[model samples]
Target: MTGNLWTAREIAQQPDVWRTLATSLDADKPRIDAFLAPLLAKEDLRIVLTGAGTSAFAGQILAPGLSRTLRRRIDAVATTDLVSNPREYLAEDVPTLLVSFARSGDSPESLAAVELAEEVLSECHHLVLTCNPDGQLYRNTAGEHSLALLMPEGTNDRGFAMTSSVTSMMLAALTVLGANPDVTLLADVAADALPDLAKRARVLAEDGADRFVYLGSGPLTGLARESALKLLELTAGRVVSYFDSSLGFRHGPKSVLNPATVALVYLSNDPYTRRYDLDIARELRADLPEGQVITIGCRDDAEEETWSFPGLGHLPDATVAPVLLLAAQHVALATSRALGLDPDNPFPGHEVNRVVKGVTIHALDE
Candidate 1:
């Protein structure tokens, strides 16, 4: 029972967890570069970013930014879609790069999607980012054409939800696509700032906003989705949650806004994206809701109190504000505890595990 105690304190102190995971990417760069070289060289390369559930959200966070950075046609597609209609998702005419993000590569949909891609596409390359090295995705790619980047150990959380693992895999994808992110610097900043973020998040969680809406543009939208899910899952649905892109929120979703709701917007550093994000913030500020609208970003000249991180230049745009997510996690944990829900096992009757369960993988016909 010695190592069995899974407390937030312990989870927070796991040996430069962020840095270790970040540094591991150094070895992956060359492999990634080699794999991506020919694909990038092609006049028309279609990059499809995919996964299931949270993994799928990782793609949502990265695709837009990656498209802008690499100047390639990148799209985020859920493996669930690939499972249902493989041909529709896979393109055969042009060279393609498939980036699959998974906490546990064993997900039936994850494995099947890979099989489907190879079967349906004449030319396809793969980049697999996962925590489980022994998972099918890693095992299947041995001596093959793909590259699999395994995250630092213990990142494969044993709890019912993914915390560190999700962030780690997302970082891996960002590193491979480009950025050449400095893991050590980003990790140091995150680790140092977490304690304070945790304290503030607890206060917010305790305030008990009836409805929570997360807003962000580009890659941060994925972070917003993950943030909303953490609160929803950790609180066992005690708090209702939703997410939307910054500009898109005004179309209709803004109707949900009221005095009793908490709206969190993740701002971008890019002027174009930030302009839209700030516009929404201005509207929210003008409405004067009784509830709070918190903005997390690197640049914060807005009138409201903003949470800004000073040394986040080493991270990619999608990753820069992730420390803000640590705050969200803390809020979820503290709020769940305050509501008398166990943070470790929020859903008592739910059988979901850290890796996942009850998934049946079928044999692909050769």
Candidate 2:
């Protein structure tokens, strides 16, 4: 309960930050329209959402929903992958719009991916979504074919893990890419859910669950990845974590479950997807009753064990995913505090970094 705990403040302030992002985007709608209108109109335009680490996960969360809404090919490729193998993902003949999501925007992969795209693609446009306006990706991407949108101030999280930063960038991408652009609604639902969610998370953290598994369906699977990373990062690797699709968990990943495990399931609001999520949760409860199982959903009655957000049932999986994001963050923060680690800089030895360091970028031609 310290104001100096940047991670806790960043996590708690997300609802309001989300609202402010919505309002700011609304005010700049005309500019957004101008920026996107022509690019969207292009025939066979390939939209590639690229980033590293937590930022890369944003693309994974948004691509499926955005591709469906826009009726175009939108792919989520990690900048790490793109940087390593530019020739595989980028094409010179095809027009490309690379949307880069970065918190600090200075990661080696961020700029390297852009450079590789320029080298290989004849026609390339960049849409940079970053929390830091002054970071390299934002400052250097101003040109005829590139536009960088910085998240409202304070989203650039000072914490070791990206709590507010990733969620805000994901929301910004959702807003601009036309995938359920109701930020106000998402923020409202998140606000409504946080009080009860925080209480549940604290109990879970204090309950001595040292192993965690996060499961989700479709776009929520991206959330699963982020959730796992948040716990791992915040706990400074003290907590072993895994993420998988709800159904996929049984294939092999379920072996991670035990008396010490906490299974966090993010259920999709979609009727079809919810079935798989519920089934997995039920199976986990039946098989590993000693392990704690937590399922988050929008419906009031799916199974006996679920955290229901009844007001948010009407929102799509992509829109409602952010609500569950807060739940995972709270859990991670609580666990970090429980473990007596500084969530702000969980790894002081610099094995990982706030902005990555010590990577030697190689020439693609070499």
Candidate 3:
């Protein structure tokens, strides 16, 4: 392992990466603000937040909040879907704004989706958020009618899983979408809280379980899916994991609950959403085997291993929940390493690079 590479162990200790990514927002804020001004000013705007896998989830975590904050029509559409079925997702009349988040920006779906949007939509603008400056998405946007924001160096995680890159991109999206009441303050809070968060995650990961379930409501549900996949990917399928909405789980998915399983419930600060999450948590605590439930939230009053975001009020929106997801990723990374797996390259034979593989872009006649 190089000095710059992050072992699962090192990732657990370096909470400062979270802080560094958060604090860097101040410097990037003006640029993001200027880039987004024209898009935000338009009332006829339809924003699409997109990417593949974890990058796709970044949009999921931000879209609901961005929609509410910007008071504009915004949707989290997967690049995979946009690439395969462009007509279903790409509408013609609206002035579209596509926000693409990618760690490497070279993923076939990532780049292809951008090209598809430009080719299919009449009026479309782009905001490319990526860590690699040389990434295809970043390079292609140069001098074009698009805005590109590159994350801090080293954010391009060497690991198969995305940690800092995911959180940083989420933060950048939130900042650009106008969610922060005080950008500096929110960034400071995230920066200060990360170290302690990582420490706690390490402890949790050490206490192993055979299976894991991640639950959330609204936009957080999508985040729950991403979190579950992270553990699954990093562990190379050693740990069986699943994700669903709090209410949706009870329909049939709750049957997977057992003494050997760990259930992670993401509670919302909004009463409407929290009521459903808490109800499920309470039920899980009562019916499931003891010591199987772990709850994470921004509130102070949950019974289980509750994670809180003090000094932060009820966001009433899932947009803010992405900030809290950093801890969860830390836990997953630590757990993967605890199981004796190499976090950097979980699947040696998979042949999937940071960019991706097995894709050929088709040429379109002008």
Candidate 4:
């Protein structure tokens, strides 16, 4: 934790937190199943995964895979969209499940979106995943229609950027949605590889690169988005960051590459998606400087410079996301320190905030 202080500790503590999350998951299974079984049985159920900021990205990361697993209409709609334009997204006839992700669970958008859903949709059930037990979203979300899941203690990150909070929520969503991945193995692999990953990120962050691009495919795309935001937040806007799907990058966004730019490709485990991810990594390597293109995770990584996840290639992209995310977190933390900023509170002037301020949540009817 010496390198980035509180941010580092939060990042380093993730694997353990993941393990604890898994251990407690079994105790929740019966209750979770009781709540979800009937809702999922409804063929017309429209599941909307949501939150604000990093919490929203957690839903984005889980939506694709969860939809595939559940074979239902699932969407990752941010609470920001729901609050600002409720009528456009909500339908009264749809039997909807609003899965909200929140760290403190108190973000104005978090509860407002849930309230909007309750008001607008004729049949809306809530599944609240939050890190804080006492936060509004968890404390009294919905007496019966809502089933609130609390993440492990200490996941309420003290850092400006979310490290464990978002990931923990993603894992909870994955398990509840029936991915039921081997959490122990994922946690074990992360614990084993995190030290070296941290070192690699520290060196890379200190390399003076002013621009970073993260590319991935499918569920990995959400990971790329989260990675981009982490760098931007930790560096306090001194460094520019962008994220797009691997194939989507070729459609004009590739212009961001330069000598001072580094591209990180989150290789997917899905065979088809991995092809595009690897292709972009190779294309960027030839286009940018020799060491500027780096691949994170998976088997094909041997062909390119990579920050490997030794035992993780066999898992689904959904399971590997949080583990692979450690690299991005460390990179942001190191980048913040290298630029002489504080990771714990990147915007000390309140130009931005850990818990965002000044938002005025208005009545949807008005």
Candidate 5:
């Protein structure tokens, strides 16, 4: 464990934490099935995955892939959005299952989202996945219509950014929602890949880029957002960070590239999407010849410009996203050190918080 900087240690320990969460969830399958069976059996059921910030990105990462696997509609709506305009995102007639993913379980929007769902929808159920058992969402949201799932110990990260907590919650959602969720294979990949990934991130961080851009396609786009946020949070906004879909990058965001910028592209395993990602990577390389463009994927012939994930060929984007997230977390931590910022508390003046503050929930007029 690194002294003072718990972020690096927490990020490095995520693979094992994910494994523990998988095992725990697997053991509780009967209960999970019982809670979800009725809601799933409903012919017209709608599922909304909600959270704040990185937790919200967990839903964003899972919704696209999980929808394909579950053969149902699963939408990712942020708690911030739901809190402000519950009428817009939440339906009154539809039987909805609001899956809440919270790291601390204490975020105001977490509880408010659940309350708003109860008020707006005739039939609503909750599948609360959080790191903190003591959190309001975990304590109050469980009942006949809801079930709360807690991650294994030590996942409640104490740092300014979420490393293990978000990944664990994301993996738990996959295990519970996936059709043939193979936790063992996902856990195995994380354990085997993280050591080298951390090293790669350290080397990249040592290279010292002033601007960072992370690009991904499909489900990886949400991960790009999370990765960019990690850098922005850990560096205390010192490193200018940006993220978008690889295709969307070419529109206008590509201007962020410079000699001191690090362009990281997360290549999709799907051949069709990978084409676009590769095309953009080449363009980024050509556009900023002096800047560093690192491709993170399992490309067989990656040349000299990639951080390859060997033996992880053809893994679904959902499974591979978590590993890439680990790579991003390491990069954020290293970049924080490069800029002489504290990974634990980047801003001593209390600009940002582990849990956001100063938000007052108002009545949503029916």
Candidate 6:
């Protein structure tokens, strides 16, 4: 295995990066609070989280739990959607907060999404979470109506796949969205589990399973999507990976499992939702080969086969989702290496890009 890949280093640095991010964001809380206080007070404000690709999935992972906790309709509108079809989503009469997430902060759709929000929405405010300070989102958001939270340096991952960038931004969103999750404990759990996780991921990748499935409920559903995308990206599409909610998988997607398939079910912490997740996990374990089906989540007295986040059982699902991703990130990186691909730049031909290109943003019609 190559030890010097930026992807591996980026993946391994997440726990420490998260701790640094926590300290810095906490120090700036007063200003962040000042910026958010008045907007959160408004009952009519529509909160939309927008980003492209991996950044968009970050919003999907955060929206359900945040909306429930905040008692507002928070939508994870992707920048692709916001750019391609702004008229369908943006409302003129409603005050809206467009929370944009970006790793590079240079994507054409990202900038176009912000401009479209400003044009279409009557009362629009911007909250830009980006890793690059020099990116357009960070530089152009100096207006009174916007607040840009630039993550500590090194979070802008140099890898082709987003590793540190995704987790850092998710932690930032949790803190900014008014949840006081134990950031230290989150990092601690990841730190404790990573070494073993890397070993397990290596075994899994080299284990001859060419297909993978990730399933979860609610916030974990999006985490499943993020995990699937990570695997697909890091492997350069050499191995197949798919995602679905636990209940939804039974409909038609369960066929993804075969002798060469490995299925991982992400159990939710919510008691009722956990039942549905367990139902699928048990069924998959029964149907698939032993060790091919695994469960991931938080629990105090977790079963032997389950991968539990040791001390984080009580955190909200959204707050806990980011940490759960470390497992998948490792698996993806390991699989990429096992397949003899460069995790840092998987596509030698540039069929895919770290930051998407060739997307022409068209003007919105009146």
Per candidate, the number of residue pairs that clash is: 0, 0, 0, 0, 0, 0
| C-alpha local distance difference test of each model | 0.74, 0.86, 0.77, 0.87, 0.85, 0.89
| Residue 68 lDDT (model 6) | 85
Give the per-residue lDDT digits (tens) of candidate 1, residues 52-117.
888888888878777877877889999989877776777455677788888788888898888888
Model 1 TM-score (2 dp): 0.89
lDDT of 6 by residue, 160-259 (tens): 8898998999899888888777889999999999898998889888886789999999999999999999999988898899999999998998887888
Best by TM-score: 6
Candidate 5, superposed: residue stretches over 4 Å from native = 1-3, 299-305
Q: Model 1: which residue pairs collide?
A: none
Q: Could you give candidate 2's per-residue lDDT for residues 143-165 as a string of tens digits?
A: 77988888989999888888888
Reference-based TM-score, model 3: 0.89
Put down candidate 3 lDDT per residue, 244-345, tens digits, no spaces.
Answer: 999999899988887778888888777777789888888888876766677777654434336666544456445456566765676677787788877777
Q: Model 3 residue 114 lDDT? A: 91
- TM-score result, candidate 2: 0.96
Residues 44-161 of candidate 5: C-alpha lDDT, one tens digit per residue: 9999999999999989998989888788888999999999999889754799999999988988999899998999888888999999988888889757998999998888898889
RMSD of each: 3.0, 1.7, 2.9, 1.6, 1.8, 1.6
What would the TM-scores of all predictions be? 0.89, 0.96, 0.89, 0.97, 0.95, 0.97
Task: Write down the lDDT that model 5 would get.
Answer: 0.85
Which residue pairs in model 3 clash with each other?
none
Q: After superposition, how far is residue 119 of candidate 6 from its true place, in Å?
A: 0.8
The TM-score measured for candidate 6 stands at 0.97
> Pairs clashing in candidate 5?
none
Error of 6 at 196 (Å): 0.7
Runs of candidate 6 exceeding 4 Å displacement: 1-4
Consecutive 10-residue window with the lowest summed lDDT within model 1: 1-10
